[model samples]
Target: MALDFQRPDPSSPAAVASAQFTVSRRGYREEEVRDFLRQVSVELARLLERERFLESELKALQARGPVDVAAIDEAAVTELLGAEAARVLTSAREAAQAMRDRAAESAEQIVRDASREATRLLEESTLEASRRRSDVSGEAEQELELAKQQGREMIAEVRAYRERVLTDLARRTEEARRDLERLVHERERLLGAFERARHAATDVVGDLNEFDQSLRGTGVTPPLVPPDAPPPPRASRSSDTPIFDANEYAHELGAAHREERTHEVSANDVVAAEVDPTDLGQVDVSVVSGSPATQTPSTDETSPVEPSLVEHTPVESSQIQESSLASEGSQNTEVLPTSDTPEHIAEVVNIFDRQRKREAPRATPIHDAPEHPVFERVEAQPEHEVVAPVTNRVDEIFARLRTSNTERVAKETIKDLVEPEKPAVHESVFRLRDEVVTPAVESMTRALKRQLSDDENAALTHTRAKRTSLTLAAMFSPVEEHTQRYVESIHETITSVAVDAARSLSDSRRADLRSTVARGEVMEAISDMLSSDLLRPLHERIASAIDAASGDRDALATALRSLFQEWKSQRLSIVIADIAHFTYARGLFLGCDGATSVCWVVDPNGPACADAEDNALAGATTPGEHFPTGHQHPLAHAGCRCLVVPLDK
Candidate 1:
C-alpha cells in the first residue's frame, strides 16, 4: 500500500531538523534513523531552495531572451547530492523518494519551459532575418534599375555630342569646298592668259618670217632678219653665161620693185591691226622703204643730211591725193619731144635730169605722208607706251593667280578634310568606350559586388578564379569587336587621307604625274599599314590588358582604366600613324621637323639625314622636298610621337 506523507515546508529549518522515520526489523536504530532523517530533510530543504533559485533565474533569463537550455546541466546538480545523501536518506527512503520525485519534477518543468521559450525566440529570429533579406533584395533591384537609367542617359548625351561634331564637320567641309573652287578658277584664268600670249607671239613670228622672205626675193638684204634665219634656196648656175644677162637683170629689178610694193601694203595692214608687246620685235620697219638708192646712201652724204625736225601733225587723205594727182599731171605734160637724132636725145635727157633734181628736194619724208601712213602712225607713238593692253591684262591675271593666299587655301582645305577624319576616329573610340567598355566594366563591378555579398566561408579563391576566367573569356568578344571597329575606323581614316592627298595633288600646279597616288594603291598601302601600325599593336595592348585584369578587383579596375585610356590616346594615335603610313606608301611624301623631339634625333651626318639632304637637292626645283628622312615614309617607331605632314607636292 502507498503511504500518504505530508510534505514539509522547505522554508522551515526547524521542521526539517525534527523530522522522523519509522523503524523496522533489521533496520537501523530509531535514534540513528531519526538523526539521518533530520540530515536528509535538511539536505532536501537545501536542494529545494536551490531548485527554486534556479527556477527564478531561468524565468528571468526567459523574460530577457531565449535561454541556452542545453547549457543548463541537470546531471551536475544531481551529482552535488553526493554519497552521504544517498546512504543516510535510505532509512527515510519513502520521504527521500518523495523529495527526489519533487526535485526531478521541478527540474523537468524548468527544462520544458526553457525549451518552449528557446523555440519561440528561434522562430522570431528567423522571421526577422527573412524580413531583412527581402529588404536587401528590393534595395539591390532599385539600385540596378537606377544604374541602367544612368547608362541610358549617358548614351543619349554621347549621341547628341556626336551629332554636334558631325554638323561642325559638314560646315567646315563646305567652306573648304568653296575655297578650293576659287583657287581652281584662278588657276584656269592664268592658264588661259598664258595660252593667248603664246598664240599672239606665234602670229608675230610668222609675220616677221614672211617679211624676211620678201626682202630676200626682192634682192635686198633686210637689216632686221636675224643671222639664224634659213638661207634662201640657190638657183642652178649655167656654165655658158660668163657675163650677166640683161633680161635676167631687168626681170630681177622688176621683181624687186614688185616686192617693195607688196611690203608697203603689208606694213599698212600691220599698222591698222592691233599690236601686242609680243608683236613688237617681229615687225621690221627697215623693210618698208622702196628705193634701194635711199637705203645705200654714202656715209659722207648721210652725215651732211641734217636731222629733220618734223612735228607729229595729222595729214588729210584728200590733200595727200591732190598732191599725188598734181605730181602725176606734171610728169605727163613734161614728156620728152620725139627725138630721132643724138643731139635731140641729149637735150631731152638733160631736161629730164633737171626735172628729177628739182623734184627730189620737194618730195615729203615718208613720216609726213599718206603714202607711208603706217610708218607715220608708228613714229607718232611714244616709246614708253609700246606695251599692249593684253600684256597688262596678263600681268594682272598672273598676279591674282600666283598669290600665297591661294596656296594657303589649298593647304587649309586639305588639312580640314584630313583633320576632320581624326575626330571621327576619336568619336568611334568614344562610342566603343560607352557601348562596349562601360557596360562590360559595370557588369564586372556588379559581379564583384555579388561575390563579396556571399557567405564568409564561401570558396573565395575558387570564386575569384572562376569569375576572372569568365570575365576574361567574355572580354575576348568585346576585344574582337573593338579590334574590328578600330580597323574599320582606321580604314575610313586612311581612305579620307587618301582622298585629301589626291585632292591636294590635283590642286597643286607643281604636282608631278609620276607621283600621283591612285585609290587602289592607297588601299593596298592601308592593308600593309594595318599589320604594323594598327592590328599588331592593338592586339598586344588588349592582350596585356586581359593579363593585367586577371588579378584582384583593384587590379582589374586599374587594367580596365588603362585599357580605356589606351583606346582613347594610344589607339587613336595608332590609327593616325597607319593613315600616315598609307599616305607615305602611296607616294604622298610628308615633311617632318628634323629637330630633336619624340620622333627621332636629327643627326646631321646620319644616313637618313644624308639621304634627305640628297633628295632635297635633287628635288630642289620641286617644292615640298625639305625634310630628308621622315618626308619619304612613315616615321612610326615604337612610342614615336612624330607628326607626319603632307608635303606640298
Candidate 2:
C-alpha cells in the first residue's frame, strides 16, 4: 500500500523530515527534497505564527461585535482564495513531482481554506479599522473647525470693541471743541461791551465841558475895565470866536483877560487828554472864550455882540456884582466864571449879596450896570456864526454846569481808562498754562499710557485666542505630527492584517516555496492595501486638514496685526485730540516743530520753532487764527510731536 500522505502541518519540521515521497525517474533525491521541505517548514512556521496572531485578532474583533456584510462577501473571499491557491499550486508542481503533487493538492485545499478564512479576517479587520479611522478623522475635523470658528469670533469681537472705543473718543473730542468755541465767543462779547461802556462814559464828560463853557460865557462877573479904556477895534468875530484866538482877545482885554484865557485852555487840555478824539464832538473854541463881563463892552446897548457871546448873557447882574465883590475882598478872584452853569453862579452871588448888604448897607447900589433884560434883543451877527439860545433862568443853568464841572474833573484822574487788557490777557495765558494746558498734557499722557496698556491687553487677548486655537487645531488635526503618528499606527494595523492574510494563504498552499518569495507575495498584498484603499483616503483627509489649518493660522495672524494697528492709531488719535481741545480752550495756539516726520500736512503749515520762541519772548495778546483742517491743532494726527503755545499777536 502506498503510504497515504496526509496534509502535513507546515509548522512541523518533524513531519516534513519523516514523510516518504514516491520515487520516480523525474523525482529528485529524498535528502535534497527533505532539505527543501525543512526550509519551507521553517518559513511556514513563521507564517503560521503570523496567521495565529491574525486569527486571534480576528476573533477579538468578532467578539467585540458583528462586522458589516458588505465589507466581507463570500464571492470576494472565494476569488482571493482561488488566486492564492493557484499561485501556491504552481509553485508546488515545480518543486517536487508526485510526492509534492499530493502535498500540493492537500496543501492547495488547506491554502484555499486558509485564504478564505484570512480574507474574512482581513476584511473584518479592515472594516473595523476604517470605521475607527472615520470616527477619529471626523472628531479631529470637528474639533479643528470648532477651534477655527472660536478664533474668528474672538477676533471679530475685539475689533468691534475697538471701534466702539474710537467712536466714543471722537464724540467726546467734538464736544470739547464746541465748548471751547463757546468760551471764546463769550470772552469776545464781554470785551466788546466793556469798550462800549468806556466810550459812553467819555462822551458824557465831553458834554459836561461844553455846558460849562456856555455858563462861563454868560458874563455873570464883568471884567474890571477902567472907564477910560478906549473901545477895542471891531475885529472880525468870525475868525476870533471859532479859533478862541488869544491874540485877538489880548488886544481887546489887556493882560488880565489873556492870563484868564490861558488858565482855561490849560484846564481843557488836561480834560481832553483823558478822552479819545472820536468821543469828543467838533472842537468848539467857544469853550475857552470868557463872557462879555471879561470883554470891553461897546457903548451902544442895542449893538449886537457876537450872537455866540450874547446868547450866554447872565439873568442876574446884581447877583454877579455881589459875588465878584465878595470874592475880590477875600482873595484875588478869577474874572472868568469858575462855575459850570449860570444858575450856580447866581446862587453864590445871592449868598454873597446878603452878606455884603448886612456888613454895610449900600446906600447906593454898588455898581452902575443896569439889569439886562433876559430877552434883550440884539442885532444879528454873521450868518456863519452859530446863535446861542436866549435863556431866562441863566442862574439855574449855571448851577447845573458847576456840578458837571466838578464831576468832569473828578473822572480825568483815573489812570487805567482806555488801556487795553493785554497784560491781563497775558496773565491769563500763564494761568491757562499752569491750570489747563499743563494738566491737559499730563492727562493726555496718562490717557495714552492707559490706552497703550489696554492695547497690550487686547493684543495679548487676541494672541492668546489665536494661539489657543492653533494649539487645539494642531492637537486635534490629523495633519500634526502626533495625529500622523496615530494614522501611521492605523496604517500599520491594516498593513499587518493584509500581510498576515497573504502569508496565511501562501503558507497553506506551498510549504516548499522559498521564504523570500512568500514574503514578497505577502508584501505585495500589503502594499496594494496601503496604496489602493487603506491609507489613501486617510492621507487625503490629513492633507486637506493640513491645508485648512495652515490657511486659518495665516488669516489669524493677519487679522491680529490689523486689529493691533487700528487700535494703536485710534488710541493715539484720542490722546492728540484731547491735548488739542484743552490747549485751544485755554486761548492758546497749537504749535508744531515743523519737522517733516511729525506730520507732513501739519509740519509745512505749522509754526516754526523760532516762531514759538519769538512768541515766548514777546508777550501774547491774541489767539492765533484757526489752522486749516488736518493741521488745525497740536497733535492733530497720530504720532504728532507738536506743542501748544500762547499766540503772540
Candidate 3:
C-alpha cells in the first residue's frame, strides 16, 4: 500500500503514532520514520520561530533607544544601555517563565485526557473480554457435551456390534450341535431298519428250505402226519428221545416204499464197500440217529420220530442253545451217517476216534424252531418305533437374530475400528492434547486474566472450566466401563473448580466474575482460540479417538482408559491450578481482606524451577497462615514451572 507523505497533517503526532510502517529484518519502518522526521522538523520550525521572535525583540529594544551616534553622554548611555539590558533580560525571563507555565498547563490537560482515555479503554476491554469469554465458554461447553455424547454413543455402538457377532456365532454353534445329534439318531434308525429287514429275510429263507425238504420226502412234517398212525420210534439211552419216522407218516406209500428200497440198496453198497461184499447182505444196522453205534436210516423201517408239537423242558432248551453256539463257533465239521459206514464196525470205528464219539449237534425240526433265536430276539417283542428326522425348527430359531445388510455393514465398521491404525490415531490425539491443547488453553487463560478486571472471576473461572471441559471432551474415548466415567466426571470436576475459584470473592463480585469470565476479551485472540484451539481441534481429536481404537477390544479398551485417565489427571491438575491462580488474582484485585499471602503451588516431589528465586518462595505463604487475608497469586512464568495460589488463611 502506498501513502502520501506530503499530506497536510502527515507530520502531526497522531499521524506519527498511527502510521503503518513496513517492518524489516534489520531496519525501522521507512514511512513511519519519515513521518516522525517531519514531525520533528515541524517542532524545530516552531522553536526557530520563537527564537527569531526573541532575537527580533532584543534587536528592536536595542534599536528603540534611538541614541545618536554612540549616545549623548557615555555614563548616561551606559546607564541607559544597562537599564535596557536589564529590561530585555527581565522581559526574556518573564516571557520564558510564562511559556513554561503555559507548556506545563498544556501537558497537564493532555495527561488528564490520556488517563481518561486509558480508563475508558480498559473498562471497554474488560467488558468486551467478559462478553467474548461468555460466548466462547458457552459454545465450548455445548460442543464438548456434544462430543462426549458422541463418544459414549460410539462406544455403545461398537460394543453392541461385538455382542451381535458373538450371538450369531453362538447360534451357529448350537445349530451345529443339534445337527450332530440328528445325524447320530439317523444312523441308529438305519441300523435298526437293516437288522429288521435281515431278520425277516432269514425267516423267509428258512420257511422255503423246510417246504422244499417236505416236498422231497426228506423232512418229516408233523402237521401232515396221520393221527391214527402208530407212534414213531424213540431212541433209548441216558434220556429217552423220540425221532420222526417219515415213512410211517408219508401219505404216498408207494414213493415212501421206493425211497426205502433205494436207501437199502445204497446202504448195502456202503456196508459191502466198508466190509466184505459177500457179507454186506448179512450186516444189521443200528437205528439210533445220533448214537455212535447207530448206522444210517434202517432199510427195514424209517427212523423213529415224535409228534410235530413235541415240547422240550427248559433244560433241553438251554442244552440246545449251548450246543448250537459251540458247533457254530467251531470250524470242524460233524460227519453225518453217509450210507457207506459198515454197521458191524461202526461202534468199533467210532471207539477208535474220541472226537467222533462226542455228542453231535441236534437236527431240530424247522417247523418247531423260531427264526434268529440267538440275536434278533425282537421277533417275540414289538418292533422299534420309526424315529422321525430332525425338523428345520432349530435352523429357523438360529436365523431369528440374523442381521440385515445395513445392520451388518454397521457392525463391520465397528469391528474394523479395532484395527492397528486406530491406536495410532488415539496416540496422536493424546499428543495433540498434551502439546497443543493444554498450552493453548493455559496461554489464552493467562492472557484473559491480564485483560480482565479483578471483579469478573466468575466469568474467568467459568471460561477456564469450559475450556478444560472441551479439551477433555476431545480426549475422552469410552471403550470399557465408561473409561473412567468420561462424560459424567468432567461436568462435576469443572463445575466444582469454577465454583471454588469464585467462592472466595464477594457474592456480587463472584456473580459478576462468572458473568464476566463468560463474556470478556481482545476478542480476536479469544475467538481465534475458540475456533482453532478449542473447537476444531477438540472435535478432531474426539473423532480420532472415537472413530478408531487400539489393536483389538482389549487393547482398544486400554487405549480408551489411558486417554481418559491421562486427560483426567493432567488437565484437571492444570485446571485446578488455573482456578486457584484466578481465585487468588481476583481476591487481590478486589482487595479482599481475605487475600492473604501467596504460596507456590508446584510439584514438591520433583525438581522445581520456582525455587530458583528463593528456596522459601516455592512453599512460603507471606506473613503467616494465622492471618485472614494471607493469600495471593504468584504466576511467575508461562512454561510449566510454578503457579502461585494465594493463601486465604
Candidate 4:
C-alpha cells in the first residue's frame, strides 16, 4: 500500500524529510533579487543621464534661428534709409524759404505799377481844363478865368487829399500783403516738414512689410512689433538731466530706482550719521525765509526744489504782547479824542494803568528741598526655587529612580509619600560615581586616542580624529557611574527575590524529591536564568555571589544550564504596554560619543509614537505578555514610558 507514506510517524529518513516539507515551505531568499534590482537601478541612472544630455542638446538647437543673422543687416539698412529721409526734409525746407522770398518781391512790383497809373490820370485832367478856357469869348474868358481859379483851387485841394488817401491805402495794403505772405511761408514750411516725415514713415513701414514677408517664407515667427516706437531724441550736451524718451523713461527709472533702493538703506544711514539729532528738533519749530503766511497756487514746472520748512509761532505769548502794545496805542488815541470826552478819556487811561499795576509779577521766596532718585527700590522674590534639605530616606531612595519611574509613583500613590526634592541626587551621584569611574574612563579614553591616531595616518581617515579629545572625554563621562550602579542594583535585587522564591518552593508540601534532586532542581532554574541569551550579561554580574557559595562543580554547571533554559522557556514573558505618553517629551538628546545628536526618538509602531525610539529598552521582560488581554495596565499608550518589571521565580 505504497509503504503507508502518510503515516503520522515516519519509518524512514526520506519519509520523515517529506513530512517536514509538507509542514512548511521554505521562504524565498530576497537578497539575490535585491542585488539584481541594484544593477537595474544603475542601468536606469545611466539612461537618465544620457537623456538629460540629449535634452540639453535639443534645447540649444531650438534656441538658434536661420533668419537672425539676416535680420541684423536689414536693421542697419533701415537706419540708413531713415538718415536719407532726414536729409531730403532739410532740402525741402530750404526750397520753401526761397519760394516765400520770390512771392514777397512780386507784391512790391504790384504796388509800384498802381502808383504810375494814378500819376498819368492827373496830368490828363489838367490839360483838358486849359483847352476849354482858350476856346471861350473874352467876357466868358474873364468869368471862366475866375471860375477856373476857384475850380483850380478846389481841384488842387481835392487832388492833394485824394493823393494822401491813396498813398495811405497803398501803404496799408502792402503791409497786409507782407503779413499774409509771411504767414503763407510759415504754413508752407510746416506742411513740407510734415509731408516729409509722413513719407519717411511710409518707407519704413514698407520695409517692415517686406521683412515680415521674408520672415514668414523662412518659416520663422517675427518678434512682436511695438506700437509707434519713435527714435529717441538727441540730448543737448549742456543739459544736466540725462536724455530720456518720456515713453520709455518710466520703465528705465523703475529699474534704476530698484537698483538704487537696494542700496538706499545706506543713504539713510549716511543722513543719520551726518545730521545732528538736536538740529532736527530745532528745524521743526523754525520757519524758512520768504515763506508765505497764507497758502498760494503752484505755478509751472520750474518751481523751486528747496525742501519746504514750516514754523509754528508761540501764539499765546505773541497775542499777549500784541494786546499790550495795542492798549498803549489806544491810550494815546483816547487822549486825542478830537474835541469831546477828553476829560473822560484821561480818567479811563488812569483806570487802565491801575489794572496793569495789579497784574504785574509778584516776588516769591524760594524753599530748597533735598533731591531724591526718581525710582525707589522694591524687594523682589528670588527667581530660582530654594532646594529643600534631604531628610527622608524613602524620598531619597525614590529620588535615585529615573524620572520616568518617579513620575509613575507620583501619579499612582495618594497623598505626599515623598517630600519636594532638592537637586542633590544628581550632584551626589556624580561625587560618588567619580571615585569609581574616573580611572577606568581615563584609561579607556587614552586607549581610544591611541587607536584614533593610528587610524588617522592615511589622508582619507585623517578627519576621523578631528574631534578626538572632545569625543574621548564625552564617551567616557565619569558621571554615568551612578546610572551603572542603579542598573546593577536593580539586577541584584531581582536575583535575591528569585532566590527567596526558589527556597519557598523547596519547602512546599506537594512535590516529592530526594534532597539532592530537589536542591538540583532549584539551582537549575538559576542557571537557566543566567545562561539565557536575554539575561546572561545581567545574570552573570548578580550570580557571582551565588556561584561562590555552591561547592560542587558538576551541580553548579547543571544548575546554571537549567536556570537559563527554564528562565527562557517558562519564567520570562514581556508585556508591551503602549509607550504613547513618553512621546511628548521624547528622550534626553545627549550624544554618547562623536555621533550627531538625535534630538528625538520615534517609536517603531507609527506616527502616534513618533517621538519614541525604534527599539527602546524600557525594562527587560520575557518574550510573552504577563497580563491578560483585559488586565492591561493604566499607562498602556504606545509612548507611555511605563515599563514592566521582571516577576522572576
lDDT of 4 by residue, 382-464 (tens): 23579998699887767777676977887778565665321111232223223333343343334333322222222112212
* Predicted structure 1: clash tally: 1
Q: Which wins on lDDT, candidate 1 or candidate 4?
A: 1
The segments of candidate 4 whose C-alpha lies over 4 angstroms from its true place after superposition are 1-288, 291-299, 302-304, 308-523, 526-649
- Reference-based TM-score, model 1: 0.21
Residue-level lDDT of model 1, residues 352-446, one tens digit each, is 13244334334435632222221221322334647555468788878888886799899989888842112011222123222332333333333
TM-score of each: 0.21, 0.20, 0.24, 0.14
Query: Where is model 3 more than 4 Å wrong at Cα?
Result: 1-79, 82-91, 162-172, 204-649
Model 3: how far residue 99 lies from native, Å: 2.0
In candidate 3, what are the lDDT values of residues 32-78, reduced to their tens digit? Answer: 55554455455546655766776787689778866566555756745
Candidate 2 lDDT tens digits, 298-394: 3442232232221222324454456446646745444443344332211111211224433533233222232321222122222256889977698
What is the lDDT of every predicted structure here? 0.42, 0.42, 0.42, 0.35
Model 4 TM-score is 0.14
Residue 433 Cα positional deviation in candidate 1, in Å, after optimal superposition: 45
Q: How many residue pairs clash in all the candidates, one count each?
A: 1, 15, 34, 31
Candidate 4 local Cα displacement, residue 546, angstroms: 41
**Cα deviation of 539, candidate 4, in Å:** 24
